[model samples]
Target chain A: MVKLTLNVVMAERNITSRELAAAIDITPANLSILKTGKAKAIRFSTLAKICKVLDCQPGDILKYIDD
Target chain B: MSKWLKFGINCVIVLGRISIVFAYLLIILPLGNFYPVIKGTLPKTILHNDNFLLLPGKHTVTAAAMQSFPSWPYAILILIGSIILIWAIIKHLKALIIILTNLRDADYFAVTTVGALKQLFIARIAMIIGDLFLASGNQLTRSWFYLVNNDGVMGATWSSAVADVWMAIFFGVIYVAYRYTLTLKAENDLTI
Candidate 1:
């Protein structure tokens, strides 16, 4: 199974959904969805956007967990 | 200014107004029509229609025929387009269901579904408009061809052109509606 720890990362960084969206140029609604991990696919550009905003790596936002 | 702040305020105001409107439109309005029913029984008919069955005009007939062509290529295109539209709609609806189901305690799945739903809605509307344009064009083409061949090619060419233009305009209105209903932003994730 694929596991995501976006909440942990967000909390650790004290990032707000609005701030993140502004930084990445996405709507907060869209950012909220991604944070909650409901997104089916993430674009590399969006990944870069998120990485840049959060000051983290792609691995920090998403990861694979054994089912 | 802030997206969340704006979203939060808009949602509250819109939802409150929507509820009030929903009450009037769905419940109050229906009950109000039953003044005698409140005292006796409801009206037998909800509408005051005279059972009119409207048949299409020449132009409308042409458009409808074009839209419903029996040609294999058109059939395949429509089938594929419909399937894609349905898929997008289903995905979005499923996302909404997830969110509603977990409102009190939303999980990642619920949140992600919201984003997915928005994207799907945009995509589905766009696809539908494209399909309509193609279908409309196909129909008008056939109509013009029949008009030219049967009724002396040059005699009614101008009239057929006018009809074609009207059909295009009608489809244009539908396209505009599809665009207006969508909430869109450039995707950061998607790059050329």
Candidate 2:
């Protein structure tokens, strides 16, 4: 299973979901979906935007968990 | 922003209401005139042959007569069917009004429009079933009195408005497709 570490990264950066969502020009609900690992898949463009906003690499925000 | 379309929808809504009232009046007025006759003939039973099997070249005809049955039960079934049809029509009209209103407001992709279309489809199915029931009731009543004509041919045939049923089913399929598209659009809209 693939898990999102967006919440951890956001926490380390001292950024709220609302602020991150606004910075990325995305809805807070969608950010919540990604943070909760409920997203089916993430677009590379969206990943790039999130990584740029949070000043992190894709690997820092995404993790592959063994089921 | 077509004025003609708005005018058309408004006219349909008004016409729908008028037709509903007219149908109710038709039912009520007839009941009023037939109440006394029906009361006087209350609980009346009738008996008649249901089938006549003609043996091949045997010069023998076997006729089976159904037992005496009260006419009121069939009458009540017809009345119930009529009421169901009326209710279905009203539901369809309401769904149409909602769809038109949503279209006018440029909310064509709203979930309420999908819900209304589903309701209209179900109501059409209900109306078709109701019509079938009414037709069966009519056939049953006719069979109670006469099943064969003077030409020795079956006279009381079970029949329904095939065109109406097919039309309803056709529109139901279209609505189902439209609803599916709306569902897809709604999901896409939420997929930020």
Candidate 3:
């Protein structure tokens, strides 16, 4: 399974979900979807923006886990 | 869409609804076989066998001919087929009205439109099968214009069967196109 670790990264950077969502120009609802791994997909552009705003690699936010 | 086009669609929807009410007459009028009130109201020109099965010298053989006419299962077949055909046409027309209404609202690309397309496809299939029964029953009914007008008003031959098949194929194609469109829409929606 592919799980997102965005909350962990956000917490490590001492940034709130609202701040990241505002910086990435996404609604907090959408950020919550991503954080909870409920989104069907993530766009490349959105991923690039999130990476830029959080100063993290894609790997740090997206991790592969087996269930 | 153009305003005129929208107006035209609305007009067609209204007309389509009106015609559905009249389409019931197709079944109701035929029931005159049993009901005297309906049979009495119809003009001789419509109910007379001579008008339906006219020969060159057969003008005088009119009145009691209906009593002698051997219309066994054929009449019943035609009635049943017409009922189903009318039902199918009503379904098709309703789906069309919904699609048009959605278009007027600039909401044509919706799951509702896809559902309407599916209903259109199903209605067409039902119509094709129903028409086969109608044409076959009409063929058996034989309007005796056999030599004069091979395919008269009530007597449609297999040629119409061919046209009906083509229509069903066209509906199938449209339904498949909309199915693909729905897939694309779903994928697009997921790509946030």
The top-ranked prediction according to lDDT is 3
Comparison by lDDT, 2 against 3, better one: 3
Residues B1-192, candidate 1: write the lDDT tens digits.
466665665565455445544434432332342353344322122112232122244333344443343344433443443444344434444544444434423343343445544555464454454445345433433453232112121122334445545655554564455344332322323221
Separate DockQ for every predicted complex: 0.08, 0.18, 0.54
Candidate 1: list runs displaced more than 4 Å.
Answer: B1-192
Once fitted onto the true fold, the runs of candidate 2 whose alpha carbons sit more than 4 angstroms away are: A1-3, A14-41, A63-67, B23-74, B140-168
Q: Please state the Cα-based DockQ of model 2 relative to the true two-chain complex.
A: 0.18
lDDT of 3 by residue, B1-192 (tens): 898998998898898788777766666755654344334422232344443454465455344554444454555665666677777777887888888888878885888888888898888777777767667765543442232223333344466667778888998899899889888877776565
- Cα lDDT tens digits, model 2, B65-95, are 2334344555665566666776777787778
> What is every candidate's alpha-carbon RMSD to the true fold?
17.6, 8.0, 4.5
Candidate 3 lDDT, A1-67, residue by residue in tens? 8788999999999999899999999898888888888777899899999899989899999999999
Error of 1 at B165 (Å): 35
CAPRI grade, predicted model 3: medium
Question: Local distance difference test, per candidate?
Answer: 0.49, 0.66, 0.71
Q: How much lDDT does candidate 2 score?
A: 0.66
Arranged by TM-score, best first = 3, 2, 1
DockQ winner between candidates 2 and 3: 3
Candidate 3: residue pairs that collide:
none
